[model samples]
Target: MQIPTKFYKIIAIFSLFFLGILIFLGVVFKIIVEKRKLPRLYIEEKNRALRGSIISAEGYQVAYSNKLYKVAVNTRCIDPQKKELFVRLFSIYSKIPPHEVRQKLRQKRGYVVLSYTIDTKTAYQLKILSRKLNALDIFIPYKVGQRVIKQGLTILESGETRNFPYGDTLTPAIGYVSKYEDSGYTKIKGIKGLEKYYESKISPKQDGVIRGKRDIGNNIILNKEAFIKKRLDGYNLHLNVNMLLQKNIENILDTQKADLEAKEIIAAVMESNSGKILAIASSNRYDPKNIQKRDLPSLNPKFTEYPFEPGSVMKPMTFSLLLEHGLVSPLEVVRGYNGRMKLGRKYITDEHKFDWLSAENVIVHSSNIGIAQLAQRLSYLQFSQGLKMLGFGKPTGVDLPYEKGGKLLPPYKLKSEIYKATVGYGYGMTVTFMQLLSAYNLFNNDGYKVTPRIAAFITLENGKRIFLKKSKKRKILSSKTVATMHNILQKVVEKGTGTVAKIDGLEIGGKTGTAHISRGGRYQNAYITSFFGFANDAKHRYTIGVTVFEPKTKHFASQTAAPIFRNIVIELINEGYLIPKNEQ
Candidate 1:
């Protein structure tokens, strides 16, 4: 009890030294535990690139991806005293009324959403405001639905959405996408048109990742470098479609559709030698950005999807084959049987009677009997193989999705003489508008069959371009045969059924076909009329096709379809194609 001052000092020093050792060991143990759990505490961040754009030939962005956001407010975390301040600030940035913001903040929930789709500018401003408010929140941890007297706000990132600048101009060809969710991640996938066809090339491929450590305060450590994996955006698709021209053609079809009371009008213009589709238009269109249930039926492009009996537009194809085989000549005489003749059990007839007609006049007049008479010269094998060579009963292999490769009766079916005669005039078979267009292009392209293409090339993120391979051209007819057919087709416009398609001072060639739409195994009163032709000058030529389905006002192609074909040519001339010298 009565120790000396020096002894007391020595005891105090030993006690202080042991206490210091214990504190040092505790600090080391805490550091070791934190280090062991560092992997779980490390921060992982990902950045995604924008989806690829769909660019038009005119350099317009037909379709693209844009970022969107969703904002939520922690109602329970908002200080009861500063509730008005939170509402005012949020209302100012979100463009929502203060009263509406107040109503949303009154909810007794963990987080209440204020806006599901705030724009980029608004989102950025709100994010800045969030950071400023978080200065105080950084020190205090807020739990879910705590009802604590504090200020708290949350902004969650929503995914990307597609934007269409031209509204519904491009239609089903441009296609559309639907949202898909896997695990906990969400994505948008193409479901139709060119979008579905080139999904791999136009969809995002990789997302950048960043791995780094965060401090206990959930802040990134500035001294440590993050490991990053570069993000890769999808490739851009540049199409062969001309936006202005496509609109022009669509306008033409719309006007004609209303005037003719036609159920539908489909048209396309293609470069003669290149097979590049300048424009593919339809009278019926729906918005890709906001599709409806009724719009679903209109999404399938009629140009590639719908097949029908092409009627007389197919006569030229059969005649070209006849010329190719030397089985018939333009000047050769054949009896027309006064417009009607029995081939097998059925009788073939023309619109006009004739005692005898030259083979050239047969095509010029679009005489069904005359063409059938010429077809009689060829055996079933010869006739069936000829249509097959003209790209019949096959898809044009367009880049667009859901292309139908129209049906052709087999040789056995053609063995029947009645079917053979009907086949010569575009019956007992079906073909799409694209196939018919491509078949007629041979006459304008000097007999070389060119494949139709909608996609021109693809551009990568690194400024490198990858062009789609061009389809190899096949020689299906001799140039001499082409010239003869061209002459006959030209006369059709100048003096026959296609005279309505003839423009003044411009030389055009085409054929007009009127076919009765069959329903329940019998021809109906409704008719499908069409005109397939070309607009040509010394310097340039373009193959154009127009089809009028179920015209209620007029049944003949010359009245319903040919005039539309003429208007298309005139529109081309107005757009500096085949312009006359005086107009130029």
Candidate 2:
């Protein structure tokens, strides 16, 4: 207040000069301090590995993952002067209309999507186009709204998508996968069948991460000091399925499905000695790549999931159990009740009647009364325990997902004569198609139960192969008992209920079953016809099973399922997978 005007002007000048210097030092300090912290505050980018593949036994890639791309345009960065050129180039590469491209570019938004799924070839071409535009300075790098437009074209990996080269072939067995949002990240997950069963082994658990410093432009600084965490890719699964054989089976089922007027058909072929599934097919298959809502019903593996009362097919198993316990002999004769008999309120009947029948003939003829009478001789514990040992009432431990172990009444229930008699002829219990097939396999495999498996091995990305552990066969019957049952089953095809399945030179042994489909606690008009059998010469041995649900044309399995079994044998021989002994 006391100073002169010139002194006050000098003091104001000094104050202004010091204030400018302090501001400069503060700016310098912020730049230096933030820059120093840049190494600690890194920009992290993750590179996820592709999902593993599913390889068929014949080395065909049934299911595999393919990398796709997402293409988008940064409208704000694109040069306004070269809009025509940009539209033309982008439209050509993206397979989109030029006018559409112009429309997208004209939008006020900084980012606009052009395509979500483009193949590698198209993505590469578009990336090349992006580089060319950048070389020509066609992108005006600047901030628009919240996005910094460093480039006009953006091509990013949209993650891997599953591809099935064979389309609908082996569906529900090869299974399917889908994309889902998990914690703000997109992930591909298996939805059904083997894909879901082996999800842990088939899906990548960890992704690669690169942590590095960024410059003022927020771009990753390329230096050797960057931290990198390598990605661990999933293991590749190898199935026991033979694609060619699987296709053949599907084709046969398709032809038979139309002729039989079946609601659905399921078939499977397995090696007798080793529990490897050779081919499993269904008539109601859908393409895993393009699944529709209607295909939902056919998405689960029916062979392992579907369970029904397996009618006469259980005769051989029951007979084998009786033989193992010395309760019945092949030549022993019993009353057949002339095709009908009453046991506790319900009547047991045969298609054709006989006053008396030999034990082996009871099986060959599928005499419900005779087998039931013979089964009653054994205690309830013996019968129940015997079937359980044969792998009934339990999952087959198969590699497929959603396997159902059909219901088997407890041994205490079998104490009732009605339950005992009904179960002896394959009622009072339920079994899946796979269980029946595997149980029948015991006879062919020398009474040793071999657990069925669809997958054979797994391979790592490092060229290491991990084979499945070999499971020892569990013996359920003596070799002599198996031989006796084998001869009995052979007679069933030669002249008995399964004669329709007999080929000229190829000897097939099997049992035919026809069970009423139950709905709302009542048996319906629909029937489930099945044929479970095996064919073997010196060179090859295979167990084949076929089930036709609600066949409109026929009721008896001998007419519906037996012929299908015969045709399958013919196909095996035709394909050189089997050799017939002699044909006159």
Candidate 3:
């Protein structure tokens, strides 16, 4: 191995350099691995102390998370005499049976959770018990649970839970939640009303970890060392509904339903110019908070679900269409004698017979013959197209769930004269209340059809507010047609069937409708009561509609529904939402 001194020195230096490079690379790799693992450890540590506060709109804490002690015992650590006394005292204070306490004490496990989330009073009592019994293994560990509704009893005597304060008032609008017996988790269900429709947005997220049960006689220790993910609360909803107006409207409906002894009542107040629903009240509504069982029919309503012949209300649409197409003028006279007209094989009759009635008089009197004759003048295609344009035979695209799109007979498949005549009077078809309201928007908004919405704005937990803008208005009718329809509706209240709804000081314009329910393809004598009105003040605008189904006594729209409209309008006037024209 005899090598030169310079070569040997060079080899030694190269070897040292290679060794140092290896050491430096190893150190760098170790640091990279440690950095990668650091985030997970940090996450676990932070989650162990995770806490959040739930604030209301007024910035008060509705719920929050705080640290507290969970008390437990290892029965094996104490003498039998001391254990028996400790178990007896604990049973009385903690409400666990002494026998179960004795059994838990006999277990070989080192830790057991006797009670979780104990208050200061109970903690003090447990401390006293621990001293008196001389038991050193009365364990108390830090834990967290939600502290909600700060000043209420955890469990009430009536077995009814302490829920949102305005439960009954918001039942139909805000839904309820219930537990699944099989899953053992709270599920947001649309037991009824708006809750069901917006359940996805309102429901709280579920924890993916499954709950496990401990063996009998073993101490149950929740791994305080184990990691748990925190849950995010459901989004808060801000509705266009004015709660004050909603309460008053509910009260009014309750009072009226009692006075009239009506079977069912529904009233909806909407912003005339914007189509924002201010309040919707239905009498005989079930309490969402207390519903142990679901009654499908009574929970929603016939107004939203059941579609019936709208009767004379369809008259306005017909008249509007006629005017829009330049087919008729308000003053044009038509022969409607004896209140009857024969169209093909079907005979259409008005409630009262009159001769030489003008189109204005026809709408004022709600002449069925006049409307039917006017419809006959238009080709079947034109009539159907007009209806479709006005949003009939389609859904109104309202934000609420389970809205029904009214049914209309196919124009291509019309096989009978009776079917056509029946449709002329709002028969042989069906329409939801929302659809009708949307259709009426054409008459109110100068033929600009606006989509209806319930949510006015959404507020985030960080105090950010986002307002929902209305969609662009669709033009469905000419201004001239709208003007003519407005004149006809004005006459409807001035000297017509809707006169009962006339406000004393304000200019009120609307229509009245009474439709008979059909059973087994025959028109039943049972009638539905309805009244729709739009009022404009110098600054404020309002549209109100009321519908009552199967009233006990008189069933006419003018007698039953119109008075309710008048009451609401009177209140609106009194509240200054509608000022008297003379004041302006």
Candidate 4:
């Protein structure tokens, strides 16, 4: 009656062998199970938070984040019989070609990403497509394992992606964030302009974590809402950037850049009394979204970075020095050296033939020869020190990165009289257009020098705002000198070289410069033409600086930059940025 011993032994051996295999698999897969669960566990512990918005003074969103959805398909869930139908219908929902969807559906192994960053409308339609096809299938987004068992289509809630509303319009000054690939992780950092300068204030770390059950897919489940840390939103930056003014300036510059076929144009507008930079625009700027084409070094707020010879623009600073030191008077007469004079080995000449002109007439006529005569009265020490005091050879401490400290020759190095003389008429030195803007503020701000600023305040999520403090003012010139210079500059706009800048009913004053670009220590045929002035109505005055680099058709500041300045001022008046003095 006993069973065969060989058969009994064989059955026992098979059972033991099968049991051993299970044990080995358990040991091996224990680590794999834990490793596979790490992503899900991490999501369960983490929260989701948002980034802050970068806004303009006028309350326009410059850089902000918006929610986007990813539409995907679980190929494994699709029946082979309905593959073509699924692809065709899903393609309609995703706006993708059916052929492409068909290929993914045919794989039938895992999930396929059908689309990314789809709008809510398309997402809703996708959900509808799932419902219509499966009849009982409801596209419940973010379920356990990124799947709705009844539906093959997976609708997922994705993280926010950034949106630049203005694109390149305010990019140069507002700047952008960059992704740094460091040590196998992507780190976001601001790499230029305000974005770079105020990174700490704008970009707070994302401490948000998803603390809920997620399906095998990393999507958070509908079972529990993510408890997120709102601290990551950081603080919103309200810049002194006037979006409309910025748009207008950019439009004008773009048109002029094309017409002139110039290399580039740099322009900015500032609140004269407060040193607030309202709008800065450029012909060349980087699109923040296009990371590949951006040349970081070339893209900048040019108004504060690029330096050029002041040309006649320096004449005002020099004349201010002469008046401040009591070395010159309004009616002080000086020979223009018959429109020419010898300085060291160079013959400094005026733009026109002049016999004699008063100190006031010198500025009124923009007489280089007259300025040279004034420079002769001062030693090199006096001239160099004067420029230093006027914010030359220094950065204006502007709220930007890579601000330039312009070239100012040492007094000891200025042994050559021509160096001193050329400096008097805006040569032998280089200053940024912004430094000029800061220096010229002295005349309008009653001889007080103010630092130019871009950011106005930081608004927190709690509804409290912290306004940025204005830079401390330093009196670089006496009030009497400021008034005298103002009167002289007004005359210049009224009846002199800057006459083109004069608004008919408004009082405006400024200087014109056509500086020769130096290459290899010699003056090139090219010139940096510019006009910077302050135009005032009854209530407000704005300082505007416009420069054209290497113009093809015109070479004079009066012709190129002056007209642009005039148009800008007239537009300001027309737009009621300036109220007429009579109206006031």
Candidate 5:
């Protein structure tokens, strides 16, 4: 055993050979990796893409874009054995879903975004996490600075994110946006409301290059050629809505939401002649900032979406139809069976007892039996045509999203006379609050039909502005018929259930509606209290519609919606919109 010098020499030679090979391989690998991850010098880039803005007619920015960042990592460079630890630590700072991090770690190569939302503060913490673990593999696409590099984390200036300055105020109407990445390209998608409807006009994909030049320190150079972007910025939508009126509407609702015990309340104000929406509001609102945090039900938009039985508000249309077609005169009397009448299988009831009432009394008293009796005289064609003339059974053609036309059955589908009778009293049919508003505006606009609109105009960066033209004009009723209808509605406020809506020395015409909301297969006790009206001054006229749903404190529109309507008019007038003749 002591004479084993040959064996010892052989073992030493083998060990030396293996050690030299190991050092050579290590040097080669380090050189390749270092070259591959070498820092670059002086970069030029462009970001010509700018998300468009939504502005009001008064030139206030409602929705605009703000820059945001996305943080990501090259999975191949991260420690493989410590993938779980990496995921846990990454999620702590990134706020990304843990399961999502795990799935990305499985890739073990290429790139996976830790978060599409790395802000300035968060970007700093990400740097700390990366430094503590030394796991970040920086790959700056364009700009880089000390601000850019923290620990080993990569900060990608991932273009812009949308912001609503007024929060949920115009959300359902203005809509919202979401982000997605496909084929190495990032995009913003308009997901709802006006955002989606005007997507092509507003936040369309970029049309030009976003160019910029930077020095070694990532300092942006201010050179014309170095930073040039042929910016075809999206057009700025100027809404017809008046911010003053909109604010007043919302403020009043907020103060009354709890007192009314309302599950929801929807109201709209439209120009009597042009149908331009001045203000539209809802009680149950959603915030675009924290939209994802709330339940989906909270996001249900009521302005142009919620459709319900329109109730006695339809009485005016019934009276207008009878007047327009010369089917009946204002003073013509109809038997009401003393405020109660059975027609076929159903019965119509009135709040007041009336054996016989004038056709005008039918509307003034909001008598269901009276209107139903008058409706029995008309042919199905006349009955259906009357509703159509007032924009019922049709979508109001509003630019907002998810607008429902509400159901309108043809004459043939009328299962019984009761169904037709119910339609007269605003049952067996459904309509959106906007549609109801537009229909009533016919009386205020001197019988010339007006189509409801939300957008007023669009302004572009080049100072070119295009105003939205009025829809094709159509006269649905004669001037005389409108006058007659207006007189009847005036009587409703003066001597009827809607008396609470009356303001001193102001001529107003309104109708109250209280209908049981249909749920599951049958009507429920849940009610939609509504008041549709026009507030008239010498020079100013506004048509308003207020609807409150499932109120706990009150079940009547006169109690819940009318007084709110009165208060709104008072505020708007006090704000100097309406001026009475006596005051003038």
Candidate 6:
């Protein structure tokens, strides 16, 4: 084991040299691994480029994005000596003053957005100015601006607008969206109508995730770099509104606008069988061209935003309630004359003087006294329950923003004569036109109440049509009550104030409502006009409601609203809403 001194020294030196070589190799390997796994201290500077498009049900692009430039100033790269020159050049090019730019630079630690969505001409000018001024820190990032329809077949040229080629035609129903600057981010928000209701699905989130594709090796690869995520665009909506029917209704409203002297008009046409809204029109509509100055008044009418006493239009609903409870047969006799009766200090009267009338006559004549007597006879609890059954005091579950749930005063609150009388004739309490229409379904359908909906289906970008689900129906009245009320309402168009609403060729039924507008809690002589219509082909079928608020000349529904109903029904007949006599 022992060797010579010279050989031992040689072995020791070789061993030490080998150990030194091993340590150096280990150090080199460690440095390489550390470099490969090094955590970067700098933040990943990302430029957000967002865009959205609006397309019709048929995939016609209504609104789409166009290229724009996003200009930003990288404060970190701005030289102290050239800061003033950079601010001056930006101010001159961007129309922003130098003081503001300087203030922004002082407050900002990194990059500061100067302006977004600049036109190409302005963007180029700024780029040229930055180069001339030697402001290399100015960054002009290209992006897509929200495309607004300037003009199209079913759209109009408006300022960054979501337009219906039909303008103001479906304003109350379809709704509009607009861009807003809030909390340092630009956003497009749905303010009303269907825009607000289905915003989530229609307007996709920016942080949406995307799944990556697999490789051929059959082993999962950890290649985060290969996959890319982009912002998902919102889905397109196809409404239940029949274009032909909607156009016809709009024309009808236009034709009657002058005579009615109305401030606003709204009409809704629905299929009584399925509760699908066929057409909805709101008058005083603005051009979707100027979305920034959206005329909220005309866009949202009495249907959704405004609630008022519905007058005798609610008679069928009340009658349905009574008949449903078996409290009164349609033929049950009630005494009323001189058009007035006093109950519990509340005086009730019909518009015209009347005598003993059947329950059917009460609805036919819209006898306020007769209805009030009936209300007196029924327990308050029963009346409230019946109102609830008819979908009163509740939202129709309509997919619209700010849908009003009209107020229904509790029975205990009806201490005054005015309140009771008004309630009997659709006063004191307020209900939206949509709520009234939904409640009116009790007479047309088999006692079932279904929520109204605007969206027929949602079309994905890939051309998939997914039908929006409809709400379940609840039995609000007995089948017998519906049948009886149908007969009574039919008589209303045949012989009562609603006779003007009758279509010549088809059997039509409806009610006329002329409710006094309450000013400061007192009923004024001015009235809100209203008409409700039901058409049948040897059986109850379609229901429509039309309302015109605060007509200057004719305040009665029979005069102002009825003609609109007549025109709508005529168009519906022409479109084959009526069965042929031979077919029937």
What is the lDDT of every predicted structure here?
A: 0.84, 0.86, 0.66, 0.78, 0.78, 0.70
Candidate 4, residue 279: lDDT: 81
- Candidate 4, residue 14: CA error in Å? 16
Superior by lDDT: candidate 1 or candidate 2:
2
lDDT per residue for candidate 5 within 1-584, as digits (tens), equals 38688998999999999999999999999877764544544454544355778787677888887656778776655555666777888788888778988886576555667667666577778767766775243222322442233224566666567778787785567777787864444667678877787887786445454345666545566677554556576777888887777877888887778898888777888878888888888766777756865536656567667778888888788778878888889898888788778777666788889888888988888889888877777778888877877887778888877788888878765435777678888988888888888888988998887778889877677878888666886898999999999998899899998999888768898999899888798888888889999998887789998988889888988899999889888876887778766688
Candidate 1 achieves a global lDDT of 0.84
| Model 3: lowest-lDDT 10 consecutive positions | 151-160
Mind giving the per-residue lDDT tens digits that candidate 3 earns over 1-584? Answer: 68799998999999999999999999898878764422122221111121122223233332223323456654334444445656777788766788877776566655566655465455666656655444353332332253211110121011112144554664454444443322321123444445555555544443323122333322233465444555444445567666666667778888878877887788887786777887777776655546646534566655567676788888888788778778888888977868777877767877778987998788888888877777766667777888888898877766666667888889853335566556666777888777777777677778888887766654544657666667778888988888878778878898999988776567678888889888898888888878876877767767778887877678888888888888888777766678887766
Q: What TM-score against the true fold does each predicted structure earn?
A: 0.89, 0.92, 0.72, 0.83, 0.77, 0.71
Counting only residues 3 or more apart in sequence or on different chains, how many pairs clash (N, Cα, C under 3 Å) in candidate 6? 5
Q: Which structure is stronger by lDDT: 1 or 5? A: 1
**How would you encode candidate 6's per-residue C-alpha lDDT over 418-479 as one tens digit per residue?**
56455766877889999988877767887788888766787676888788888888876778
Error of 1 at 131 (Å): 1.7
- Residue-level lDDT for 487 in candidate 5: 92
Winning candidate number (TM-score)? 2
lDDT value for candidate 3? 0.66
Clash count, candidate 4: 10
Residue range 48-134, candidate 2, lDDT tens digits: 777789999989998887767788877777778987888888888779899877776666667788777887788999978987888
Local accuracy of candidate 1 as per-residue lDDT tens digits, 1-584: 78899998999999999999999999898878764423366787666666799999979999998756778876666666666777777788789999988777666565688877776788889988887666634313455463333445665556667888898887767888887664424467788888899998999989877787788656556454867788888889999998988899899999989998988899989998989888888898988889989897788988899999989988898899888989898998988899888876788888988989899999888899988878777778888888888988788888888899899998888777678778889887899999999999999989999998888999998878899989888998999999998998999999988998877767689999999888899988988899998988767889999999999978899899899999988888878767765554
Clashing pairs in 4: 44-211, 46-209, 46-210, 47-208, 47-209, 47-210, 144-215, 145-215, 145-216, 145-217
| lDDT value, residue 95 of candidate 3 | 65
Better of 3 and 4 by TM-score: 4
